[model samples]
Target: MKFIGEFIMLFGIWLLLTWSLAPAQVIAGVVVTLLVTGLAGDIFVFKASRAFNPVRIFWMIVYIPYFLWYVVLANLDVAYRVIHPDLPIRPGIVKIQTSLNTDMAKTFLANSITLTPGTLTVDIKENELYIHWIYVHGKDVKEWSEAIAGRFEPILRRIFE
Candidate 1:
């Protein structure tokens, strides 16, 4: 019952984002959305947390542009390294300690690492994240540790903490 409502709300959001107002297309999309909802049910159980606060969602909308800018900056940095003769990549793994205390927060941290180019989240253990970076910008692990944790963690803390 709760899952049905969540599915419809999420489907409506998808419609608004895509701007699909055509009658036939909207019906088709709803059908596909239902299919996806059914399949994903077993995986996540799709329950809105009892502690869900609308303020978090509002902040996410406010933060979209900032995330997009970071995405673009990371893209250009990767492109620059790929084109330069020097191939300025210093590949290595480093551990980043996170103050995040929930599955949601850890998931967001891992995603942010992967979304930013030049880094991959290799694994997460307790409150630390293991990341593989293509380039160690300053060879300062502490700086890298603080970069993502500081840049994105506050907003996510507001969202999920």
Candidate 2:
């Protein structure tokens, strides 16, 4: 059951990426997805009970719009900073403790922060994530961390934790 779900999810992603209906392309995608699923089924598929939670799916769906909006905002902020003559950037690394308990949730938070403009995830030690900000907004670690990662963390926690 888990294998089937993984195969379907992988194949769906393959289809979305390939976007070709040709028989040969689909066949190749299915073959590759199947092989990959077979090799990493355990990692790709969650345990039986958690694998197909509708709540997680709902959160995942909700996350997309929020993520896109944040990305756009981040891009605009970076653009403004670049265009401004003063080059308004403080540029410092801040360590923030993540609210998420699971490593996967922490990883998701780190990746999202890295993907956002003006911020880069430098390192992760246990629950602590170090991020370099192009413009330091505040000196308070908790507030800074919340500004950078709080929005995504709760959604990611619901989806992955």
- Measured against the true structure, the TM-scores of the candidates, in listed sequence, are 0.75, 0.82
Instruction: Spell out the clash pairs found in candidate 1.
Output: none
Q: State model 2's lDDT.
A: 0.84
Q: Which ten residues in a row have the lowest lDDT in candidate 1?
A: 44-53
Which regions in candidate 2 have their CA more than 4 angstroms from the true location?
17-23, 42-51
The deviation in Å at residue 130 for candidate 2 is 0.7
**Highest-TM-score candidate:** 2
For the record, the alpha-carbon RMSD of candidate 2 to the native fold, in angstroms, is: 2.5
Q: What is the lDDT of residue 114 in candidate 2?
A: 87
lDDT of 1: 0.78
Please report, in order, the local distance difference test score of every candidate based on alpha carbons. 0.78, 0.84
Go through the candidates in order and give the clash count of each: 0, 0
